[model samples]
Target chain A: MEDTVEQPKAHGPHGYSARKDDHVKRLRRIEGQIRGLQRMVEQDEYCIDILTQVSASTKALQSFALSLLEEHLRHCVADAVEHGGPEADDKVAEATAAIARLLRS
Target chain B: MEDTVEQPKAHGPHGYSARKDDHVKRLRRIEGQIRGLQRMVEQDEYCIDILTQVSASTKALQSFALSLLEEHLRHCVADAVEHGGPEADDKVAEATAAIARLLRS
Candidate 1:
């Protein structure tokens, strides 16, 4: 089991450092907000107030997803298009499917 | 604008360190996996093969969420239950709503 524990891997060269860092930072903030929400509930805050926080947290997550999607389009999709082949088509289709999933969410 | 950049906050004592660390680690792995999936598509891999990787990436995300949900129930919900009040009920309700959102996703 100890041997199975994987080391943290670095992002590839093509990885967008600025956007990825922003996403991780935002997520950590969201994680803290979630913990705060739990505390509010455990302290017996008003139901409406708790629900409001839930909405905020959900919106934060959605915002993160949108930012990530935009970054993907600008970087990954653009690269595929420049290459210009079946790969480009595949990249577009994959991105479309991802957007569809986000919409459903 | 630079002054507005918030410093990274530390998790509270109530935060489950082991589980949170595991979750973050898993998510980083998923991030890498997502990048890989994009590359696969951009390289013009077979449609079916790209789809398979997409399925795997999605499953990894689901696994991360499930782990997070379990940790929340064990720590946050259990804490609320121990307190025993309207807060406990709110906590449970919040958790239920979260689970519903996850199911929809």
Candidate 2:
């Protein structure tokens, strides 16, 4: 809803921007997890150790994905309907499919 | 690979940053598409017309998801395995499941 040019933005319907500082911070944490894995490899750490890091990274990524998806539905879909048309129906379907995929994961 | 604080960054292992200007530009385009959908509705466009835009938006979002998934595999998974632990297996399974979900959508 608020746009600042400097923020990291995820584009969604209606020129909507997902520019959240916390999102970026979470991504940075995920990035750190990845780096830690890299170091573990170089040190020849145990397999289980690496696996744990991987698990953490995956969950982190999923969490971020869910957040973005939530915003998409709330803002994009809602706006589309207010402006109503076939677009609304299409957005609903598209969002539903996306959610289905997330749940499947 | 490059580190620019101002650039849009997707952090993965080792503080690796997906700071691609092109990616951000593409996101901006997607945002614009959404806004266009908004206008179409305000004008009371046909259902089919709106549906067409929705389809386009879905495709665009899917494409973006695909790219991110690809990156996750190349960087995070690879690093996880090299570290070799239970973590490695977990990461592989996680990545596989994520891919399956994407395909389902």
Candidate 3:
């Protein structure tokens, strides 16, 4: 099957756009896990057990963010750097801020 | 309104059991945030914007875990310590392990 990204009008397709389906699937699974945590809470599962699940959910989220960041650096940031302009610095700084947010969160 | 925890079978009501509704509400909101991320990906939203949202969701999950942990310390661990037995040490050890999991995750 063709892996060409279906471009959106607002801007060029993102690095992740090619693997959109895979990303969506990963997110949906994380969503399900969150819902399962809700069910466990409703059932009054042990507190430690619920905490374990919460940790797992958080890890899943961080993993997703890391994957997206990788693609952003490989495509968007790299493209900007290749052009050798002030925008390249801006892109690098912007990416750094995003990483800070992830770390703090 | 009566805040008396509705005890569950198999064991006494857990520390967070009294705030079960609150915990469930938080989980549901986090779940919604995850779905929102999926939509952002589907629509090809900027990766930075999506990353921001992911950080927010992760923060929310951590907040929920911290709240639950506070309650566990106030009730479950406190109760175990009051009894002054080997079980109290076990509870503290178990809680520490759970916290470690959260950190590593």
Candidate 4:
């Protein structure tokens, strides 16, 4: 906790920083889809219809994830690999774990 | 559009009508999570942390879909099967299609 308490700024920006606005826009749209699902439920819409929306929202979230993952590989992982050290391995491993989680979900 | 415009009341209500409040509540929570993700991106939170949250949100969406699907099977599909007609086949096929879409998404 002591050493990790540095600060977000200490790392400059994250891999996603370059596409921050795009990410935020995509998230806001996903939020709208969630709200739409709530409305469909409240209105007693057809079950299959609601499920379809769920699928769309899930896809959108995954798409956003893919974008973030690409940026991560391009910037963070690439940078780490360039440095040629133990941290490079950790970065790639961390990214792999995140991909595994996404796939399982 | 003609047949579909018959009104939602024509079908009574969907299978999820039984747990309307629960579904709405879950959706609202998911919506909150999406907003949190947006904030994370805006704040330049770590890429890994954002990806982790995306996985959580995606998982939650899928969970909601599963719940809706279960109710659809227990109620709508069951009713159609009990009636013993072509509609039963249609219901089963529709559900299968929905599941496939979810998988691909």
lDDT string for model 1 (B36-102, tens) is 6455534434433444554555555555556556666777788889899999999888888867765
lDDT of 4: 0.88
For model 3 chain B, give the 10-residue run with minimal summed lDDT: B1-10
- List the candidate 1 regions with Cα displacement exceeding 4 Å: A1-105, B1-15
Which is superior by lDDT, 1 or 4?
A: 4
Q: Rank the candidates by TM-score, best first.
A: 3, 4, 1, 2
Residue runs of model 2 more than 4 Å from their true location after superposition: A1-105, B4-16
Range of the 10 consecutive residues with the lowest summed lDDT in candidate 1 chain B: B1-10
Best of the two (2, 3) by TM-score:
3
Q: What is the lDDT of residue B97 in candidate 4?
A: 100
Query: For residues A1-105, could you state the per-residue lDDT of candidate 1 as single tens digits?
Result: 112236232323332433445544665666565566555544444333444554565566556566656656776778788889999999889888876665554
Error of 4 at B82 (Å): 0.8
* Candidate No. with top TM-score: 3
What is each model's TM-score for chain A? 0.81, 0.76, 0.89, 0.88
- Candidate 3: clashing pairs of residues: none
Candidate 2, A71: how far from true, in Å?
24
Docking quality class, candidate 4: medium
**1 or 4: which has the higher DockQ?**
4
Whole-model lDDT values for every prediction: 0.57, 0.55, 0.88, 0.88
TM-score of each candidate?
Answer: 0.46, 0.44, 0.91, 0.89
What's the lDDT for residue B103 in model 3? 91
Candidate 3 residue lDDT tens string, A1-105: 124456552235787776788899999999999999998888878899999999999999999999999989988898888888999999999999999999999
